[model samples]
Target: MVDELEKAKPIIIKRVKRKGHDFHGGSWKVAFADFATAMMAFFLLLWLMGNTSEDEKQAISGYFHDPSGFQEKAGSSPAVIGEGGANVAVIEIETIQPETDDIESEISKNEASNKPLSEEELAKLAEQKEIEKLKQLKKELEFLVENSIDFSQFREQVMIDITPSGLRIQIVDKDKRPMFDSGSAEPKYYSKTILRGLANVLKQVPNKLSVTGHTDATPYVERENYGNWELSADRANAARRELLFGGIKEKKIARVEGFSSSILFDQQNPHNPVNRRIAIIVLKRSVAENIEKQVLGVE
Candidate 1:
């Protein structure tokens, strides 16, 4: 029995060294490498936080406070808030100041107060004023005619009519009181009296006046020396001078036109006596109004 036991113990006498590759396992080394990478990332985040500005910090905080906080993970910048969170800029809100009720009220009042007069109203007022002026002028002229000694001598030539243009006072041919010389540009004696009366009446009214001269169609044999055109122009100028002398302002006279058988009373009857005369016209105020508007650049 002792010899059999010695034989069983002698069966496992050879012991060999284990291989180095078989003893090593990589699980602990991989876990240590992962832990080192995590520590490096954590330190980088701390360095970035230390360098951040106040505005950047506030912006980051605002991003976190947003309702969809996780949406900023898509690399979008957050809504910016100013320093100390006191001055925050909202992108959706406009910065303009609202107009007050007082300002609107003042604008409305000015618009209403500066409204312009209508065309019809202006025309009616102008016509009424012109008619009133004409009536007053007629009364004064009648009074002067009544007081004058040679009123009847002036009667045959003197005439008054209210045309569409306003007033037309004609002084036609008379024997001793010819408005102009028979064959010259010179005016006669009694013509001055008629002009003085017309000027006196014109000065009282504010309406503008135009003095026009007309001549007979008879072509003079001495037309080469003194033509009808020259005679007509001279007569109109003479009338203007007489009017100025009798107290009518030169500014009140708009213009003086001379027509040599051009604008006759009877176009068919060229030799009519009534066609040769001087006319005094009281122009409508609309002419002055239009000129004023043109100068001021108003519509």
Candidate 2:
């Protein structure tokens, strides 16, 4: 019985088996996925191109060709050959070319003919017009002041002139009637009446205003920290407030400055009472813009 059991067990045999694709593995699957993704992207591009307008297509092409907008225009940025044949950057300023016969050139020509003036040209023209306007305003102001019953007494004290800055209206201190109390910022009754009349006329125009206060060469005793600077500044601020009360918009007052006996109206006599005055200036737009730029810390 043992021999029969051994012979039956010994009859069993072991064999090795192998699959066909063991070496290739999953590499082909990755390659097929990459191919499918590329085909999808290509089809999307085709679809977009088919739907896009000519201008849009041109714009897209331009973006791809020159991604930077500062592309080299003719005579704008010329290249210079260096000693070692290396390229160096050089700028060349040239006048804009004249009209041409191409359709685009014709359109550009028409645009150039009908186009608005350049910034510089427009500024010059505007300045000229502003000068004329200020001249007219000066005439009107003179007429108004001359005819007004309230300003009859103060006629000689009012001085209006056209300056490079704009119209300057100076109210001087008179021997009989002072604009302010001695060594004070408070305006007298007559001063208020004059300021109010000027404000009424000034409010009619869109120009900005600059109010400046001047003091005579008379010395002030330093009581605490108060001196000429304080007095002058306070007087300027006081004038600004009065102008606001006289219907001039607060925003219209661009500057309030104090020049304490520095810029004298009567240079020959620094101590002249006329040096103690208030100057109201209507600033030109360009000058005002420059002042604003300076205030904003721009170059």
Candidate 3:
């Protein structure tokens, strides 16, 4: 009975020893390896954060949180490189700032330098200059007509308006003194004197000038052969000829338009005496340039 008991005890001890050898716990080694790997990752993150911009760092932080639009690319390790020349890990920099600030600086400079004048400001300046020039011309015309006719009446008939295009000097016709002899294209003696004075003033200015003739809607009874169009055109041409005679260069005359009653002062009252008139249009250089381009076939 003692010998059987001893044999069973030895067998049980041998089994226990075998079991201990087979199931040797490795939890300490696994914990040590995990600690080492975490330390390496921590250092790598620190190094990458040092190299990346603020925007890029924020992007990477966002990617880790959601990874919705993040894509992994094959590249160099943001950490230490392996001796075998294979990249084991990578750090992505998503938002890189532009390096050249010159473009931004140049845009700022251009904005500062090339500011344009407002429409109101431009209009005010043009009107002021035009008014000054017209006042000077008015004085000269008053002096010229002092001998023959009452200059005060002429002043009331003539008016100068500054427009976006340029200065427009209008000679309005009335019952007392019509600019043209009733339906005829011929200028009255006083009207010729006034036109010569206008030409003399125009010759001093450097702007391009245009002569236009306008007539009231009253039909001609005596000169039925020459309609309003022909009379208007002839009157404009006569004024142009007088301007040339008064020392104005023939080339400076831009155009002569005969607007027979189409552009009346008062369309409802077509027989208004003011509708029968002559207009001297002074064009600015900018306006002349646009006209010149059209004439030369330039786009």
Candidate 4:
């Protein structure tokens, strides 16, 4: 009777069925892939922001804000969403115009200068700018002399130095190679080339030029009437002609003078080859003005 009761009461079996994520069928995998992609994009955004310049960031922001307002030259840098490795500087981005009239006064207030410059202030500023310009020109000339293949053979003969007047470029005669034929105004081929090259460079600047020709103490015996003075003047004119041929304008030439053994480069040895030189002076505006005034007997 006891066995019969136990069998009737507890004859049930407990069977558990196992389940798998296969029921979802790659849904979780899709979510995981999306998460990874988003992480990668976030890292990339951080990298781009770090590499971009402040101006570029503003430009990009401006673009996103108002693409219609964007203005830039064609064929500009497009590879990196910024400047590519081009010879030109990165294009300056123009900001979008203000939409609201309320900000107009504020903009004007910001744009308005505190005070206009006085004449004296203007002159001082101009003088400062001229000094900077001369310094930069000196640097460029020095760089050309040091690294240019065109001036390789004539490096020793080309001397550049800043003077109280302005920047002075002297092309002196070497022991073996003189700029001109013996006691002649005609320039050597290489000398002409040097002057032409210099003219090409100098034409870029707006400064007036002064060219002077010099000769050694040795007197010219080529002609009875013509001496070193006339020879020197002829040489100076010849140099001026070459400069003009090389694209320098006629108006840019301020003075063309000749000092025959008067302003010796080698004062101790006036007869030295170094004393014979052609000097190109980019005169300071003040000095040039003073010279003009003195010549004209103005002040």
- Per-residue CA lDDT of model 2 for 1-299, tens digit only, reads 99888888856577878677854789888888999999999999999999974434544554455544434322243222222212121212121111123334544665789975566754565566667777777876786566455577899999999998888999999886889988789999889988977886687677789999999888767577777777888888888888888789998888999889889888999888898899999888777777789899987
Q: Each candidate's TM vs. the true structure?
A: 0.53, 0.61, 0.51, 0.60
Q: Against the hidden true structure, what lDDT does model 3 obtain?
A: 0.66
For each candidate in the order shown, give its overall lDDT on alpha carbons.
Answer: 0.64, 0.74, 0.66, 0.75
Give the residue spans of candidate 4 off by over 4 A.
1-121
Task: Mark the regions of model 3 whose C-alpha exceeds 4 Å error after superposition.
Answer: 1-150, 221-225
Q: Which stretches of candidate 2 lie above 4 Å from their native place?
A: 1-116
Clashing pairs in 4: none
For model 4, the run of ten residues with the poorest summed lDDT: 80-89
Q: How well is each residue in 132-188 modelled by candidate 3, as lDDT tens digits?
A: 554454444443343223243586678776666666788889878898888777888
Give me the overall lDDT of model 4: 0.75
Q: Which sequence of candidate numbers ranks them by lDDT, best first?
A: 4, 2, 3, 1
Q: What is the lDDT of residue 72 in candidate 1?
A: 34
- Tens-digit lDDT string for candidate 1 (130-220): 5655655554455445433335467667777667666677877644456777666667777786787567556766677878888889875
How far residue 203's Cα lies from its native spot in candidate 4, in Å, is 0.1
